[model samples]
Target: MTSLNEIPARTESVELEPLREDKKKIFEDILRYFETNQRGYIKVPTGWGKTFLSKHIMKKYYDEGKLMLFLVSKNNPLLSQAYYNRKKNQPLFPNSALLYSERRVDRKELAATLRALGQKKGEGFVLFASLQTILGKQSAEIKDLILKFTDLAIVDEIHNFINNRGNDFLNEFGERTKILGMTATPFQGVVGNVKFVDEIAGDMREIYTKTLPECILDNELAPLKYTIAESSEDIFEIFDFEKGLGELDRQDLFLDCSTPDRLKKVIRRTQLAKDVYDSMVKQRHAKTLVFCAPVRKRVYGVGGGDKEINAFHAKLTSSIFNGDISAKKLEKDIEPVLPVDFKNYTPEGKFRDAVFISSELPKDEQNAILAAFREMGKPPYVLCTVGMLIEGFDFPGLETLILLRPTLSMRLFEQQVGRVTRLSPISGKQQGSIFEISDSIDSLYQRFGEGVFSGEKVDQVQMLQPEIRLEELFSEGDAARAIEEGKIEIKKVELGLRGKGKGVKIKEVPVKLPPTSIRAKYFSRLLALTEEKDVGAFEREKRELMRAALKFRVRELRDAEELAKLAANVNKLKREAYEDRRLGDVSRQHKPKVFGEVEWLLKLQALNSLKYEGEHLSLQEKNRILKTLGFEPDFRKIDSHRLKCLKLGSAHKTIPELVKVLGFVSRLSSSETYQFLDKKKKEQWKRELLPAVYWGFCFIEDSPELKDLFESTEWDRRVKNIIRQK
Candidate 1:
């Protein structure tokens, strides 16, 4: 077994070269960060092609004749995976060799191997080893080799190296060569004032920013539907090994705790997975992976001797390969103990599916099994393991994940969920499903709650929300026009009266003002009308207000001129009231300005009403409108019902008249015009129409006038869909 303390020393210096397009981008970014800051971290999410990027970095320095050392975990699976990934994709490092205790070639022999490869016209050499082998008996040779040849050190899973007092690897390695530590999780516990590189840090990296829910909605991964199994007691009770073995002596409890109970649970949860796999096999068969926990428990007999019990243990000691039995044959006897259901169950073999139960297998055997499985052209439908399938396993065909383990760590949860999110080669869709069976709903909620868990923050700014809202705001013709003409002014103003007091002598009175800006140009224009004497001028204002009330509005909605106009209007109106000759019947004398103000306010009110009506249409109603207009209800062509209604004039009170005008202007057929009239009667005509209205405005690509009508929105999905049809 490999111990954590004994890390091997890196010996060979490999010169690497850039190999792939994506790798080149990563290499440039890493080099740029290194040059400017001296140290930085690169966190490419698993399956984002980290190996290609690493090879590219190696090649860049190798071409410069600089020596580089690649440090990886001592596990055979990880080491072998890295070696093969480099060999197949990156041929520049032909001199790369594996370093493990079992294959411990002496220094002189290794030097010869290096020299042989060095003579092959390569830029550099790479020495691979387990960390235990490096720090143990091979320490002296490895240290000397590193001091002699190493220029740059690349440490994988660098997060594991922190906080160890005796481990001088980081300090010593940093003293000589540039140290780059790479890990999916970079932060350990809080250590004040320790400078380190981090690609993802703080609350920004949480699930809120990159949530599982959002991933499922976008079809980046399959959505998870959970089922809870009721338990009499906590599952942790079964794992309490500290209690005396005698406590489990009860026959009834023992029988209940047998393989049947556990198997039943597994069967219920995995039934869906099996069904999905079988369906895929029947149609277009594809590879799948399944993971299960180890089933090994120590049972103490009445005689006080402990015996290991496993589902496969009985099969290891008995075999009937031959009819004859001999004393010498007993030594090599082994039984074939398949799972209890294996005898009754038969795989159709339509989809090539195999099972690899990895509980007590030796490390080498486990690695060999995984390697063999990976090499298969049509591998197993399900690759099962305990913890092995959670990380470092990348398969693009993996489109479904079944989670039997319940975890509170969002990091671990996401990592496990990510196993099957790789894009499918056949469908070209990055999709997968996660099925979790657990009784702990609270645990699930807590794990995915409103804070950071497993190194990912849950408060990330929502990308879709902002983009969608922007698209909606700018999709309207008037809104877009105001934005393009720079007519919209979002600013704040203070309201105060400098000249008079009601029914009293004038006195110096100071007042504080509210801090808010006017956002709409029409509102600003209305405010300007307050400065004019004739209230009729305000009524004749051509601009329209999109929002309902100036009060209780967002600061972004107000403009400076609008604020000034409001203050001037109120002040002037008040003065006119006091200056009027009629005192007793003042209402009758100043009724004109009041009515004028009300008229302007009503126009603003009407515009707001139109906006509200536009938003109320349903998808079916919008679709009906499109169909009536002799256009197919193609979502990609026009996704918004609001925009459709606005185009058809079905959103406003005078929609019939408006539709007639549109028909005459466009010379639309009578049938098309009649269809537009019929569209208004559809249910949910308002709810779905708002988005359509916004999108339609955004889709008028060539018409600058129409384009100017939509300023705050972008030509995004909703608009693009409409534009595509146009």
Candidate 2:
């Protein structure tokens, strides 16, 4: 065990400019806020260099001789990102350490080193630990040691730290400690409720739309498209608060899906999705990603079971270890599973083996699988877990994503999509494709609707678009021409002679012409001619065409420039403006109003209307009363007064008085009437009043009435209710 006393006092700093102007401003604001207050929250989207910023901040404090603790989620990818950032950009932290599940170190030695670095007896040094390790008590001693020296703490994936299990750590740190919580998804429920020492930094939509989305759409980065599948049954029922939530909390129910039978169901569904992917690949020859749930196998008698059974299992394991398995099985079982239709799959000599990657595999095995998959000829596909692929894994040849799992959280869904969206460095192409097979449309909608709702944003849900028959795109003659052209490139490579040795000139025998370039041109022409009459349609076609062309191009272009240009063109089409333009002007004009309407609807109050006449109100009379109260009245615009009245219901207010007011409810429930009057007398809490306040900067400049209402106590109660609802 490493002791704190042995650790050296080595810390260094690096100068870094923010990746973008907005980022720079946001970074400065965050730093300034922290400088004044000692703690703050910064919300920036993934790929926006949050890790870089964290490192920069760490370096700043390290240079000042303050002990800073950088905390991250237990996720391996995130840990890897931190490690890479430190190693490459901030290399001066000789005392820095990584705490994760796989890494083991001597605690005594570490502690001694920390002590030597002035960490003991109220001294401190920087330490890195995953939230899980911290929470699990694995790093209890280290955590305590750091606590002595800790002046500041940086929390990554802050949202995860707010959950019930994580709250303990937060509470432990408490008000005394200055803490910074960082997350891309800042609004887990209500934005205001999220804890921050002083200030919240950056706008989520602005950063995503202006920075990340632009990079993706411009093919400066990898582009992503989503495909939503409508569900036949309401999947929400399975996640209902009363029943499903409790079940999810229980280990048995949560892990039940990992059972062999349940896994079979998943496998069957995955195979069906894989079949669709296969047809697409055959038609276009594209690389693809196959995401699956975690694999947990119970080797019944492997390690410490019955002696006879253990011996047999041990023998089998040893056989696997010694390479007794044939190359075919080694390729099949050891290598990552590639997306191929085994039912009628015939490899074209190039793809001899498929790759299978899983988190369950040992690190050596995982590396070997990746190497084998990469070594396979063009149009290689790999089967990987959602867990492993969501973070650090980058394969440029990945042009297609086969979504085998459905997720609702936009952050997770987007991250998974991002795996394929990264421009394949190998091919230098900008865009990728996705093939999603789901039983439910709502699931698809939830996963893909965010960007679509933003009129200025391109709909990324094109990955799920159904495949169209390619026969109509070209005649047999055209197909033949493409095939011939593709073969020509192969012939050129094969016919070129080379000297194998001195005085031995090898006559290069003509190699069989491969259908690569011809296929790419055919796919490109097919894409160009593909009719897209709507934004949704255009996005779908654009992604598919890009996938096909890039898959072919990856084989031809060894140069980066050509690949980048191809990628850029594909990315441009994925943009909302570009897709909308392709769909014609009507879409562009309607987008803003549609978003505005949705926003308005979210703020509307639920009410029943009634009409009254004299002492007794007939059904018809009650209907008239309801109609007069603006319950169902047709309103052309959503203005301040109307919005207020919608939020604050009326209760048996005089119709004439209501009509006199610019916006008033003629009738409301008795309860509402009392509540409204009560609300009028209270002091407002500005942060709690407007429902749109949760939208942060969007409603910051709300009308005076809204601003005043928000400052009242009544607004606080309403905000609490909204938080509870979330």
Candidate 3:
């Protein structure tokens, strides 16, 4: 083992940006926060020089004889790889002990470097390692050397590690050191579950946040523009017999992207992009990164959605690696591709191989792909990937992002676009363009409308949309002419821009395409499906909201097929929204509310209704009682309050909630009244309280008052009591 004295440090070079204010501000802010704070976070978008910011902070502390531990999650080795590359290219970045994919020499250097940093008090050192490696399988000595030597830990991708594994590290770090957690999308971890950023970062005190637009204004990040294509729903619905094909979730996306029909669609679009960019933007094959969604199948057999559509898929996965048996079994349906993690299914319903097309590349292979893509003379000039390159993979030469897959998450959509948004020197990349193939995401379209084309001003930092320009790939007139003339059309759009800050915002703008131009008239087959909506905009939007709510309810119950089928047709959805009471037909007992809102009144009425027989109460009389309690009685709630047994309305709940509540209510004796009393014997927040005071799974959360009344002394043994009640 190398000892502390064996490590050598190169003379730390001068700062990468000695005079850049944007760079200086980050280091200074971190330093200021570190002075008094023990743990905090800094939020920075990707490609906004996070490495540069990290370098200045690390260098500042190292020079002052303070040791820093920069922990990056292994899942995102791109950060580690990125930092290492920076150290090689930028002279000012410090020599840190990087513990990711290490060669023998690299390991020796790390050990010796750590040993050296441990011994020297005045000499500064920064240790870089993944959370899993340091704490996952390391020996005690290695762990001790890391913990004891570090004064402050600057964690990149802070949200990534805010889980149980992250807690394991934080538990060890404790009060002995300070922590500066950094992430581009802050407060983005588990929404329902406990959040790590909230717990560790604590309101991001002493933090500086700048938007993509602001960064562009400072020339710290590249400017972006967007173009759109029609949704893939039409083709997939018509051709794909597979269930739940258009959902845009992982499995749906994977199945759509890898299939022959869909793959051909994506490949064609990519080629078109290359041809268009070459003719329009530059005289080159548009260097592109095509983000392909994976092809997926159930591990065991047919999936949940499969059963809904009566699809009993054949066994295709098992015995594949063994090779002969799986190949023979799936020979009819699947053709052999590279025996990588890709699978093929045939027209005859047979699967060819156990391979999966969209399965993630192993780290070694992923790193290799990244390395090759970085090479200027590589053949895969058009690199295709799924989820890996969304962030951290920095290829400035990448001029275009072809979003072949759809994403709903705004953060995800932004990160995918950011991949091409790097200003490149070697490839002479000036700006990154995003080709959105579908309107599957609202935030994406909204960003284009509000932030880009409409030029609507926004004040909030969160709303400081990146200065993106969106153009109609095919104008209405162009589409009409293309249809009439039987010609191809390529859609091009541009927006004029002006600089407001740092003289960088208006440095360059994409030129608008002129009418009567001789450019290729490229059109997607998807155009045929883009008929204007029959309903007016406001009515259509209202109907969609109602339709979405019902779909959400169906989804909560795991009714994938119903939701998928309902989502497929607009007219059908509109009819359902108008006709179904659970949707927006509010005249019915179960009135429409927000998607997740509980049908409290309707639910309680369905559970149990006991007639207050001793008092001769009218519907109006009982309605008074419910009104006194601040609940406006629907006629059902009032009438149900008068019944002795539970009403049948309880069956109306979505299946899961209905089943769970039924089971819970059945066990509760009719004699036990729910109580929420302030008395010492029965304090507030007791479990008996009919209105739920505690939060839990949405199903068993009952109404303020339950139903069912038992008049018999022994309910099961009461014939006389039953006769009297009747």
Off by over 4 Å in 2: 1-22, 84-92, 115-125, 135-138, 174-177, 187-221, 228-272, 279-287, 293-354, 370-380, 386-388, 391-398, 408-411, 423-427, 440-726
lDDT of 3 at 613: 22
* Pick by lDDT: 1 or 2, better one: 2
In Å, residue 522's CA in model 1 sits off its true spot by 49
Give me the candidate number with maximum TM-score. Answer: 3
TM-score of each candidate?
0.44, 0.50, 0.52
C-alpha RMSD in Å of predicted model 1 compared with the true structure: 25.3
Between prediction 1 and prediction 3, the one with superior TM-score is: 3
- For 161-277, candidate 2 gives per-residue lDDT tens digits of 644555556555533356777765443322112332211321111222223444443334554433322223333321222342222222111111222333233333444443344
lDDT by residue for model 3 (562-654), tens: 232322333343334345634222322222221112223222322222122213346665454344323455547543342211222222334
lDDT, candidate 2, equals 0.40
Which of 2 and 3 is the better model by lDDT?
A: 3
Global Cα lDDT for candidate 1: 0.38
Q: Model 1 reaches what TM-score against the true structure?
A: 0.44
Cα RMSD for candidates in order: 25.3, 19.1, 19.2
Error of 1 at 119 (Å): 17
Candidates in order have lDDT scores of: 0.38, 0.40, 0.42
Model 3 clashing-pair count: 30
| Candidate 1 deviant stretches above 4 angstroms | 1-25, 36-38, 84-92, 111-123, 164-167, 187-284, 294-306, 309-354, 362-368, 375-379, 408-411, 424-430, 441-726
